[model samples]
Target: MGFFQRFFKKVEEVNNQEAAASELESELYVESPEEEAMNLWVEIAQNILVNSVRATGNSVDRAFVLVEMREQPSFDIFYQKDGDLVMWYELEDPAIKERIENELLPQAPSVASAVNGNFAEIGQPEITFAQLQFEWATKAWFSHIIREDDAHAKLAKDEVLHNWFNNLSTEIKTQQLDSDTKLSWYP
Candidate 1:
């Protein structure tokens, strides 16, 4: 091949390689912001359930499995079956406590009674990322509970829940940070 033709071919190959590399990098690094938020939500849900269960001095009814809600942020529901009553509890934003009390409770007295009577209520439960996996499984129960039907509302609520869970999880994890490890290793 002629020198100029060979040189041009090599340059074109190099450009193609660079373009492929850029596309691969973008694919590897690009993640949906919603997905990241959902992950944070999962961590938070696990923590709250753990802390709440611990505070109550009762282990989760392991006979039941954790299920995530579809079309929602990181929230899960647990259920146990009895002769005539099916018990259900959802782990979600702690702020749902207020909503449950003010809105849902009055409308769904049975659900309210189940929540108030059977489950122990712990305010502002704190948990660590490591501890999270031990409490709740990664799979969540999918469902729509009213406002979730609206796309905009669901997105807004999911975002809010994600932020709330992230903040709380970070705070709890930070508190558990090993200050002694740094000092002792350095010393």
Candidate 2:
């Protein structure tokens, strides 16, 4: 098996596993608060992506769906077919951004939110980021020579966190979803 072959196979396996899990969940279904929020987030996220693509006239397969962590977590769609970013989601509208951000506030806090404290001031997200960093660093995914305290003396969170983000990007590569679209998270 070559790289692409193995990659697709793994994706198919994951899809199968998810399908099995979903079936099991449906059989034993009980809608909890967490599950309810997750369902809502999934709907909003999908709507944003679909609407953005429709507005831009770009195909999802030829674009990158980025969940940016530097701000209120929202979809950052980018068209990647023409080498340059030909299509970008216009999220500069404050009303639109806020509506999405407010709805997603507690529902979809990401790794970057935890690392940079962008999503919440102080919470479990931060703890999650710390644990994630410790695991990845212990595994030697990237060098953690710089201390977090030292990096925090300057702005933009920490250099060490940035390094971790870059390392994670390398680790995850560009994940191809079942919809044949590329997706990744960034700090």
Candidate 3:
């Protein structure tokens, strides 16, 4: 009887240990705040991108979402979700293009050097690389309200990106950048 009692106790202890280990493992896979933020932005980008592709009445082109982080400044850019590399200028946002020219192009060299490593140092970093790679990546997505043509149907699902951006908390974003971390996103 005594031996059986000791055996049962040991079994219980082992089960408890296994349960704790499982809990810890699950916690390890949980997304960090930065990852969560990236995901949210990615989702928004995807929604817009899908709608934009429909505007062309064309097939999928190459698409991506890139997050560029540096010490002084950071940027989150969304490429059209379709990854076929089609010429998709129908949805290009001119205001965004202008802002990129004024703000991002000038500081691109430093950012490029940091992100691309030695390749950026070969010569003056091509601001066009940054423009084409990051800022211009999102040109494919057109807002429903902003469209001038009747080709695309107005969908209520399209998020006004500027309004979405305004709603993001700057404090939380700054905190996320504190870690020596880089974050990007996809579905």
List lDDT for all candidates, in order.
0.31, 0.36, 0.32
TM-score for all predictions? Answer: 0.24, 0.34, 0.22
Model 1, span 1-187: residue lDDT tens: 2334445555666587844433433333333444443444444444444543343233332112122233221332222211111122343344544443353323323322222222223221211111122222223322112222334333343353344344433333433222221100000
Pairing residues by index, what is the TM-score of model 1? 0.24
- Model 2: per-residue Cα lDDT over 1-187, one tens digit each: 2334445555666587844433433333345544443344344445444454444433323333434343443333334332233324234446544544454333434534433442233221211212111111122111111123433323343443455345444543343322332223323
Model 1 residue 11 distance off true place after TM-score fit, in angstroms: 37
Residue 173 of model 3, lDDT score: 42
Q: For model 3, how does the per-residue alpha-carbon lDDT over 33-90 read when each residue is reduced to its tens digit?
A: 4444334434443543443333333333322222222332233333332322222332
Top candidate on TM-score is: 2
Model 1 scores a C-alpha lDDT of 0.31
Error of 3 at 80 (Å): 12
What residue pairs are clashing in model 2?
none
- Model 1 segments more than 4 A misplaced: 1-30, 60-147, 150-187
Candidate 3: Cα lDDT at 42: 42
